[model samples]
Target: MTLEQLQTLNSIVLHGSLKSAAEALHKTQPALSMAIKKLEAEYGFEILDRTGYRLGLTAPGKAFYQKAQELLLNAEQLHSLGQHLASGNEALVRLAYDAVCPHNLIFNVLKKCQYEYPQTELHVFGESRFGALELLQKAEIDLAISPWWPTFHGVGDFQALKIGTFEILLVAAPQLFNGQAVTNIDQLKSEVNLVSEESELRFDSENLMLIKGACKWKTRDMQTLKQMLLSGLGWGYIPRHLAEQELKEGRLVPLTPQGLDFSIQGELCLVRREESTLGPVASMIWQSFVPPL
Candidate 1:
């Protein structure tokens, strides 16, 4: 019935568990459970179905959560607008980015916004794209800056926005390539190590495009993979942003071996709660700063 109760219900649905929703809210499990219980009483419906360790939303729960998302967004927009108008200051904006995205474009854009909208406050968080979705569903983030996972289509909470596209590069420390740019799959296997990014997460497909090369390591963490490549440990396919500095500095070498081409396709994406209203300050950034995507 209340915003907080609706939020609790939505968070459970988003995160699929009380423990995670509690963690996102920085509340204890017991507190979250009680909040949900309170909502169940007020609504006279069962919102969650326990599945061993997972929580599934009932039909009504799913529909209710969608409305809650809109309501929360609207409430935040109203609050942000009033606060900004009263003080004539920039309003607080919280956002999230995909951790796999090393471009740091969001930082640059925010910096530009700082100069343009001096009264606006921007707070940012870094999370994997999947984690970012959780933040989006909880209405914890004002905007999401990351790559689009098409599977995300039809998620009712977001108004998805396309930004721009970037490239992924096959790279490694110079030593791995022995100072020669790789051109063929056989050469890549013979000359260096291959680090495959476990991309099964966003794709949801068992079949992956494994670059034909010598396998050195496999990691799900982009940071760990970057560090490993930086240490001159092995070669891997890395996001262009992460390898930009290294490539510029000649610390990392680009290898165009066979099957090396990889990209996220199309453009970067943004998702915000469709129902939320934005203050003038937040609206300016959202409308003006997307940069022709």
Candidate 2:
């Protein structure tokens, strides 16, 4: 009938007795009984089985309680949403992050945001290479976390904070080279090279560290590229974090060609467009990474 009445029933079911429910709900036992009685009288059915020593729901009451529980959850969310709107929090915030960014770091920030802004919906996207930057450049997302390269300065007018660093190691299963260390790039000339490509090919010209003459296989994300490398299909660069265990287990081995750098470290930055103004929730997330002064 009312949320309070449904809450009373839920409390009784949870606590297993009217006396305990009364103590929990701050109502007298007699009043709790009258509430259940009123509900049964209106519905023409017993809502609780009084014959048992401990209180239990009747067969029909079980079904009714299930629906009531759903209603209570929705009501709680609606109340939170009302408070969120009253406080002028944005309804939604979108974030685009590079696949190479450490997931735990991003999730930790998001966990804090969720607790502080329960009603603000967060939409997250995992992108490859310059994918997140491209989305931010187009004004499609409120925030982005991606590996920052000097070439990115030419992408757009943007501001960034150096949140962390990411290392990409040139790796492949040892079987690719018959368990021998590759001594020259010529050894890979005939082999298929796994490469993770950007979603929109907007920064294809900036593809550094790629084996120039190798037969190339393009993947859309790092996981797929890692899988291909693990399968001995080709050698490619992958985030060091993603392949740490594999490297330890000798499933993947780092490659060192005669003159090529086998590993590269770049600044992982949280970026936003210079001209775009962020909403309250988005601004909160952006400020979360600011160093304490």
Candidate 3:
């Protein structure tokens, strides 16, 4: 089928009716209905259950719609690749980082790219968990530096390099635990545990790494979570570097209890789609992830 027909079908599914899909596509209802009829005629099966007041996809229609989505995705990727080739240079490099990506390392990478790749434009944004991964999947960003690993198989031909290791420390305001070491997971359940929202990047039960079944105050940013802990709202696992000052000043105390390791290790990884080749400038930034001599 034609791309227009596929896109029309997608709009019908999204907007939930022929009239709404027609309005969205700026096409008349008759034209939209005719397109679906053509597809049904060629396939020898009804694509939609039109007997209802609203249009709904039949079993075959649902399956065909999934294939249409894949076709649309590949078409968009093909267009982007063509643009990249026509530009001679990649022109723009989009980088996404999670909360745990070391600030010092990021600055170092950017500083070097500034001097070496002055012609290239750099765009940076912060994302946590698999949020950054979602951007990469959509080809919205060139690379992702994330602390969480891919939880599923067949995540495209994405290459990931271990860039650094950061520390995750479970700490709380001194009075949150009433001067008692947190030995059991259940002890913190009653208290609000400030934590990042559950993310798709977590392959393991890292949520259970902390106090399982605890009432959690979910936050979008790790810095915010640290602030919540500092305010005595809850306790959570904060990166060592981010909480260094509080730990040193005695505002936040690291939990140390027998049989419970409150500290966990986290890896900072550089991720990118393997199919896309980086320009010289983007390649320079990639190399900056390496340690200095």
Candidate 4:
């Protein structure tokens, strides 16, 4: 019914507790509760399921929450537009990318765009590659940076523009190989230490790490695996970016026999859903990454 009510609802939905939401909104619990009740009565809809310790939004509440977010974003954008009108015409382009994707994809592209057209803004969200695809499908983001793979099964009709490709490498602590080299899967049989990625882990389902007789050592995150490698506990397939510094300093060794590295053919792509209004900023950012090649 009101902006205050919408803000309160959104906060409650985000924080999942009346007390925390009230604290975030700088309102007393009783006052917040009363305001929510008034809004519910006016809208004739139940928003919060507060009969428990953690309050959850009902179905209607979820819908209202999304609408509220869009409204708030519009209002904020309008305010920003007013400031830009007086100053300059700069607006942010939103992007979400996978962790393994090249870090400089957005940065380099944005730098070029700014150099060519300084009146534009850039906002980047680095996340899992699969998650980036979801943001694209939901129209929550203008551009998504991911590897060359169909994220959702059977959605092969999506458009993708390849930016560049990088190699995936294998790394192990110096002690893991006893100062020698590891080549084929036979040498790695049951000897391989399967270090797993914990953050942004949307892409690793379906036992993708099977290597002959390798013993799996699945940790919840990369830090653990990194520590394991540093401590000479096991071997892992690390992204070249995550290990290039270590490899350069001789902390880890390349396991590809030639003492080189194995490559998984990683590629960066700029993507948008088929049905969406990609503004001028989105098109420019995409072109900035992939030109007339």
Candidate 5:
């Protein structure tokens, strides 16, 4: 019914207790209960599952909660639009990008944003794997670009467009492989595999890490992985573009073990929450990303 009642219901669900929700909203338990009863009466459907030991949402209540969340987000966006219009300058655009995304591409887009939207503030967060997407879901960032995709079923109203693909090269110092082919998983697993730290955070059933080697080394950044590979400490996947010079100079050798796919490929995607429309500045930046030739 009213925004106040909707927020009250949301709080109750969020806090999972009438008393906790009351404390959070600075209201009493009786008032919170009254609000829920009013909503249920108006909708003619149960919103909260009072049968549970602790208050929980019923089937209909779950659906209603989703709709309420969407409505709340839209309302917040409307308010932000009004503020931007009144000031003639948007407040800020929070952006998070995966480290594996090409630096040149990102910097080029940033330059275009700075030139076109001088008044808008850009707060950039550099993350890896699903980190950027996690921030996007929390509404902490307005836009995201990462190689990571959502779970197989996907999240609510999240849209991702293919921006470009980066080659995931399996390379190592010649000493590690000794110029011998690494065809079997066992041989590959025997050597230390340098991989991104973000790989550990993935829990999706579909999005499994490329290297399942028993002996593994983790680095927070790609540069560190490259350095370790050059030092013959470990062998793992790195962006082909970053290792192009090394590959050409014979400093690193690609491993193509028989019956195994060594060259891992991935796409960079521009991801955003479809529930909220992009502001003018964010829109401009979003359109600047084109599929790399």
Candidate 6:
């Protein structure tokens, strides 16, 4: 009927006797017995079989005790969550990572945060070009992992830590070129360029390593763009790591446009708004990416 009574019954079951349960709970044997008696009377069932040398649960009591144990576990978790909130920990933290950034870098820190603050909920989103930054600027996310671009410098007052580097390579399915080496932009003009469209519409015109004057097809994310390239639907730039196996297997081949670098490397950064305040869990995640002093 009550948590205290339920706890008393649990102690008796664990210790196998009222006297032992009383000693474990720092209470008198009669007091422990009174708690159980009240519980059984309220529920109209005998909770324990005292005729045995050691106390055992009655058939009905087994089901009742099982339910009580589940309630006790939930209560403990609720108490812990209340304490976590009281300590200035946020109940939820939002994180957005650019599709171009490797998940391993961000997950390394998130895994630690999850272990330390099990009560805080993590909302993770994978965004296309500039998507993470847009979310951060809109105050929709607490943190973002994205490739750094000069365009970002004028976008917001952001604090960025260079976490790693990402490379985008121009590639196409070998079948698109029919085993012929592509040496000029003119050759690509006849084929569709599979471009991953910018996440933010304002930046839709921005193109990275796009071949000029080529017929274009657009996708919302790089993964689809890579799939399109793999199917010989078009040629486009994609994260090298995303297609490493395909490139090596000769399913996709790298392209070198004349007078232009087909491969581009950029800094992958952990970004947060300079003026926003982060709660305990978010701060812990941010610090996890910092190098040792």
TM-scores of the candidates are 0.53, 0.82, 0.63, 0.56, 0.62, 0.92
Candidate 4: stretches off by over 4 Å: 1-80, 83-92, 112-123, 138-140, 149-153, 189-192, 195-204, 217-228, 257-261
lDDT of 3 by residue, 199-293 (tens): 55435244655566777778878778888998889888877888899999999999765566788776778888888887776777788786677
* Residue 63 local lDDT, model 5: 96
Look at candidate 1 and give me any clashing residue pairs: 73-276, 90-119, 90-120, 164-268
Ranking by lDDT: 2, 6, 5, 3, 4, 1
Query: Highest TM-score: which candidate?
Result: 6
The clash numbers for all candidates, in the given order, read 4, 0, 0, 4, 1, 0
Q: Please provide, for model 2 over 1-293, each residue's C-alpha lDDT reduced to its tens digit, 9 standing for 90 to 100.
A: 88888999999999999999999999999999999999889899998999989899999999999999999999999998999988888898999998779899789889999999889999999998778988898888999999897777777888999889999998899999999988899987768888877455356543566777777888787788889999999998899999999999999999888888888888999999989888788998889888788
lDDT of 1 by residue, 66-169 (tens): 78889999888787668666865546778787765555556677777787765566888866435566677678877777667566665555677777675667
Question: What are the runs in model 6 whose C-alpha is more than 4 Å off?
Answer: 201-208
After superposition, the stretches of candidate 1 with alpha carbons farther than 4 Å from their true spots are 1-91, 99-104, 112-121, 128-134, 149-151, 155-157, 180-224, 260-265, 290-293
| CA displacement after TM-score superposition, residue 284 of candidate 4 (Å) | 2.3
Model 2: which residue pairs collide?
none
What TM-score should be assigned to candidate 4? 0.56
Greater-lDDT candidate between 2 and 4: 2
Give model 6's TM-score versus the native structure: 0.92
Q: Say which prediction, candidate 1 or candidate 3, comes out ahead on TM-score.
A: 3
lDDT of model 3 at position 290? 62
Candidate 3: worst-modelled 10 consecutive residues by lDDT: 199-208
lDDT of 1: 0.70
lDDT of 5 at 224: 77
